[model samples]
Structure formats: structure tokens, C-alpha cells
Target: VLRGQRPDARVIEAVRGVTFDVAVGESVGVIGPNGSGKTSLLQATTGLLPLAGGQVLVRSIPAFLGVQA
Candidate 1:
């Protein structure tokens, strides 16, 4: 579920009920095989994608750098 604007089409849920926290000095990694919601989680967290449920609070805005060829 993408966040703000409601889509005029069908919805596909990629990630669900994912929760976690990171401290100032903590480093977290997301690991999973293909089609395991890894990219979805990052997109939702960084505000590139809207969240269907729950909330995300970040100390600073996230910057998304595309993977270059």
C-alpha cells in the first residue's frame, strides 16, 4: 500500500507488519532472497513508497541514490 494518494488501481502489498529501530550508532542490514520484500522495505522506510500501515519516524530525511549501470 503506497502512502498518501490513493491509487486508482488495484493494490499489491509487498511488505507487511515490519517493525524495527536504529540508534545513532547502530547499523542494521536487511537480507533476504529474491522476492522477499527487501526492496519494498527500504522504499517504504525512505519515503519513496507509501506505507500501508504503521508509522516511520526518521531523525533526518533519507536520500535515495539509484543503482547505476
Candidate 2:
């Protein structure tokens, strides 16, 4: 290892300040402009990504089939 060196610690902000709910048997949708983090919000709710903060409540396990960029 190199002496007196620091590692890179970078972070990105995807989604923020989002809140909503759906009633039983109700339908819902998420819409936004491209690169607006529609997918990132979904990922956090489904557990595909670790949430830096906040919480997700669900009646059942989520299904994920995410594609790589």
C-alpha cells in the first residue's frame, strides 16, 4: 500500500423528498422527466439499493428485474 494516501469516498444524490401511498386494490404510477430518478426511487422501495435514509412499508416482498446502465 502507498504511504500517506487517502481513498476515494464519493456519493451521489438520486431521489429525495418523495412521499405517497396506495389503498388496497388501487393502482398507481410514477412519472417524471428522464434522469429524474424515477427508477432510483423504485429501487430503494424494493430493496435493490440501500437507502441512505428513509423507510419503506410494504405488504409483501418486492420483485426486481433491474437492468444495468
Candidate 3:
């Protein structure tokens, strides 16, 4: 590979076909085995990761999805 040349990228579908809703004051949890994209789902929802397809609706003006040190 040439210097400074970007390598070919592979696309892996971490999360797909997932849909859910939390009512006002409702709560939920995501549980899955390792490599099952649990973190991917949350990241996508929180704007950390971009979604190939799908959308997230946040009622709060600013959603605190993660804590920054």
C-alpha cells in the first residue's frame, strides 16, 4: 500500500432490524451475547455511531447517552 493511502474498508452490519419504543417514564434494557451489537445499538441511538438505516427519536432536548470524563 502506498504511504498515506487509505486501506479498503469493509462494512459490517452491527445492528439491524431492531425497533422499540419507551413510553413516558418507561425504561428498558438491552441484553445480548458478546459481539451481538448491544453497544452498537445504543451508540447509534445516541449519535455516537451513524446508522446505515433506521432512525432514533429523542423526546429530550439533549439526550445524555454517555458520560464523558
Candidate 4:
């Protein structure tokens, strides 16, 4: 089961099996077409979204600073 939901239930996989690494001070960008999971990947990486499988490791906790405000 995922997030208290049934395993057999239909669900949308916004992101799946994504893997990568970024060294300190390295620059990176997440680019994709609409509904291609760019935001989902970022959310999963920063713990905003629960991961269904695989793992996410970071040197430190991520902070989400929105443009607004």
C-alpha cells in the first residue's frame, strides 16, 4: 500500500525510478514537457511527496522557497 492507500488501486506515477547525483556547488536543472514529472521529481526529492519505491538521498535537507513572497 502507498500512503495508506491500497496497493492494487489505480494510481498515477508522477515519477518513477529516477536517479541522479549532484556534487556540492554543482549546477543542474529539471526540464521537461508538460505533465512529464519535473515538479513531481522535485517534490519527491525534497520530501514534499511520498516515494512509492526506490530511494532519495541528499547531503542535507532541502528547503522549498517559492517565488511568491
Candidate 5:
């Protein structure tokens, strides 16, 4: 999720600016090749990363596949 790093890096624009939403009873899947910004997107949505140009919001618990939840 930490893209390019800099001593004073304050802006963090996620690759491609991918964003989406799901309803109370809706389901969605995120499919992409390796290193396709999937993890980054999850992290950003989970408030683990900061948005550079936009915003991300999550209203439920997130269960990460590999990393600690």
C-alpha cells in the first residue's frame, strides 16, 4: 500500500484511483492479476493508508486474507 516513499511524502494517490461501493445485501468481488493494486485498495479502504486525491470509507469489519485482520 505504501507506494513511492519520500522523506516528506504527504500525498498518496492510489494507482488508477479504483473505487466502488456495495449495498447492505450486495456482494462484490475484486479480481486482478498479481500486484494489481488489490491489496493497496483494501488497505486504503480499511483506513490503513491515506488518500492522496480522494477519499475512502468503510462501515464494517474487514477480514484480510493473509495479513492480520
Candidate 6:
């Protein structure tokens, strides 16, 4: 969903119409060029970003930034 050069939600869609599934004990990487919403997607998926578009389900408790569980 590479809409534009910059990560702009208003001007263009960063991660548009994207979805996927992962099994237990699996690892995935969100790789892309700069301003490609890599971090945005990760944060959104981890319940760090505000509820602007979709939903995020956390099966287990997450370890947030600067905090320990």
C-alpha cells in the first residue's frame, strides 16, 4: 500500500487494505523504505497507536516501551 513518498494518512494511505494471519511461535518482519508506515503498522498492530482505522487483538499481554511485564 505504498501510496506516496511520505507517510501521510491524509494525503495518501500508508497501509491501505492490508491484512494477514500468523501461527503460534512465528516471526514476521515489516520491512519497507523510509516513511513507508513500517513503524506505524507495528505500533498500530500492537495497540500503541490511536484507534483511527482498524482493530488490534492482543492474545497475550504486551511489553510496552520503557516498561516491563
Order of the predicted models by lDDT, top scorer first? 1, 3, 4, 2, 5, 6
Scored by CA lDDT, what does every candidate get? 0.67, 0.62, 0.64, 0.64, 0.60, 0.57
TM-score of each candidate structure, all chains considered together: 0.65, 0.65, 0.67, 0.66, 0.57, 0.59
lDDT for position 36 in model 2: 86
lDDT of 1 by residue, 9-40 (tens): 55667787876878979999999999888987
Q: Is candidate 5 or candidate 6 better by TM-score?
A: 6
For 21-66, candidate 3 gives per-residue lDDT tens digits of: 7897988889999989987787767766655566666664435355
Tell me, by lDDT, which candidate is best. 1
lDDT for model 1 comes to 0.67
User: Which should have the higher lDDT, number 1 or number 2?
Assistant: 1
lDDT of 2 at 45: 64
Tens-digit lDDT track of model 6 for 20-48: 77688999987889988887677656545
Q: Largest TM-score belongs to which candidate? A: 3
In candidate 4, what residue range of length 10 has the lowest lDDT sum?
60-69
Clashing pairs in 2: none
Mark the 10 consecutive residues where model 2 has the least summed lDDT: 1-10
Instruction: In angstroms, give how far residue 30 of model 1 lies from its true place.
Output: 0.3
- Residue 50 shift from truth in candidate 5, angstroms: 1.7
lDDT of 5: 0.60
Instruction: For candidate 2, write residues 1-69 as lDDT tens digits.
Output: 011123554445778788787788999888989988887787776666666566666544333344321
Candidate 3, pairs of clashing residues = none
